[model samples]
Target: MLRCHEVTIQVPGRVVCDHLSVVFEAGQVWAVLGRNGAGKSTLIHTLAGLARPAAGSVELQSTDESARGARARARIVGVLLQIEDGTYWGTVAEYVLLGRFPHSHPLMGYSRDDIEHAEAALDALALTTYAGQRFATLSGGERQRVRIAQIIAQRPRLFLLDEPLQHLDLAHQARVLDLIATRAREHGAAAVMVLHEPLWITRSCTHVLVLAGDGTAHCGPADEVLTRERLEHAYGCRLREVDYGAGRSFVPDV
Candidate 1:
């Protein structure tokens, strides 16, 4: 589990994360919901330790107190940012194996277990067929799945994903999101993901953190946070919830 207490992040004249405090509970999926520039991504990065909070701290709750350093933190937390920039040369398997670097023995390279875990992660994401393919050669959705596979191989106690549904077809998006949600639930690892779609958050997340543009948080259960009023308030638009037969969807009235 990860805890953010009274965190504040300032960038020049902007206060991206304003005295924000939240807890990511184990075995639960948390969906961070907000419109663009609402600090969802900033919060994710802060939790991942990529960006230090201007105030307060991010602490990982672990059974073993030994797992408490940067290197140890890498093994305890995995991050899947929206962008995959340095992924041009390595094979899919190699890229995924990089997730094991934090645990690799010095001067020993990757172990047999590391390779097996990497392969299993690829297979879990149905990317085994593309194992030998270079990262640069894969399609957008394929690349996203591959990136997720890498993160899965990390075997972290906590998972942080930013806009994980981006650039993927509906099927792949569902597959990837469902897999993460299921794994987190089964393994008792905490998961925090940023999602643009209200429906995905409703279906996949146990908890929701709705962020408004002015840096206020509406935090609660998924059903409570996914209301039309909350969506309209966070997004600054009128929204209507339409129930058609089996499922419902939210649409902007603007």
Candidate 2:
């Protein structure tokens, strides 16, 4: 649903990617893998229209993303930043309810449907029990889950998630991945997530983008781009591949 046309992303002194052209289709989950400072987050921000690319352009559903207004863009794109600096003193439910802002009528306030959506999102992330709790009082992982719930409540066509697995335990991480992948498959949504773990890509991702930290990248179906040699080159390390009943797993050879 989203296409990058010869997009070039740079951060300060470093070039993240140059002339990177790729399409993220509906019903697909894409994993963006790169080591630290590789500009993965920068690439995501550029796609979300939160940052400007150095060259080329991005399109959402064939229209120029920059030409769209903020509210118009919000209706189609949901973005989860790697770091959320804003502080919300409201309750968990109230915080998540904000996600429905794009759909809610400003003068009419939140509708019953909006509340239901927020509640369902909270439940999906296993945060229904904490709905009444204060958002500022939650643990790190709980807060991360809440952030994800907020995005789910938005119900946008495209999900741009940066470091989505941050601060979560293994179980929660698995649940989050499954939830995103299932939503993309069932609702015809598209998700581009910045992830550090390659094993999760084997589990849920349909496509992979590997940034080599030198303004070069590889993008293709997960099976084609997630090979041991490519990952080793992109990550600049040796990775040992092991096969299990479920799928393959990669670990540091050292």
Candidate 3:
């Protein structure tokens, strides 16, 4: 549902990716893999229309992303940034309800359907018990789950998640990954996530994007792009591949 055309992303002294052309389609879960400072987060922001690329353009559903109004865009594209402001002083339920802002009427506020969506999202994330808690009082992992729940409530056609597994425990991580994968597989939503773990990609992602942090990138089906050589080069380290019943797993040689 999102396409990047010859996109060039740059940081202060480094070019993240150059002439990067890729398409993220419905029913696919994509993983963006890279070392720290490799511009994974930058690329996500650019794709979400929160940042501008040095060259080329990004399109959502065949139209220029930047051309759409904020609410209109939010209705189709949901984003979870790596970092979030901690200034929100609302209750957890209130905070989650904010996800419906795009769908809410300016004068009428959130509808019953919006509340149902938000409640279901919270339940999916296992945050039903914490609905009355203050958002700032929750633990890091809990907060992360809440953020993800907010996005789920939005029910966007495309999900752009930057480090979605951050601060999450193994169980929560699996839950989140499965949730994303299920959304793509069953609901036809597209997801592009910045993930540090290769095993998780093998478990759930259909496509892969590997960035070498030098303006070079590899993108294709996960099985084809996640070869030992490319992963080693992109990660700048040695990895041992292990055969598993479901798929392959890459572990650090060290």
Best by lDDT: 3
CA lDDT scores, all candidates in order: 0.84, 0.93, 0.93
How far residue 68's Cα lies from its native spot in candidate 1, in Å, is 2.5
Model 1 C-alpha lDDT per residue in residues 1-254, reported as the tens digit of each score: 78889988765666766777788888889998888877788888989989999998987778878886777889989999987678368799999999888888869999999999899999988989999988898888888888888888988879899988888899988898888888888888888999888777767889998887775787877877788888888888888898756566688776
**Root-mean-square deviation of each candidate, in angstroms?**
1.5, 1.9, 1.8
Q: Tally clashes: model 1.
A: 0
Alpha-carbon shift of residue 219 in model 2 (angstroms): 0.2
124-200: candidate 2 lDDT, tens digit per residue: 99999999999999999999999999999999989999999999999999999999998899998899999988789
Cα deviation in Å at residue 17, candidate 2? 0.6
Each model's TM-score, in the order given? 0.94, 0.96, 0.97
Instruction: Name the weakest run of 10 consecutive residues (lDDT summed) in model 3.
Output: 59-68
Output the TM-score of candidate 3.
Answer: 0.97
For candidate 3, write residues 168-207 as lDDT tens digits.
Answer: 9999999999999999999999999999898899999999
Model 1 CA lDDT for position 226: 81
**140, model 2: CA deviation in Å?**
0.5
In model 1, which residue pairs have backbone atoms overlapping below 3 Å?
A: none
Q: How well does candidate 1 match the true structure in TM-score terms?
A: 0.94
Q: Quantify how close model 3 is to the true structure by its C-alpha RMSD in Å.
A: 1.8
Better of 2 and 3 by lDDT: 3
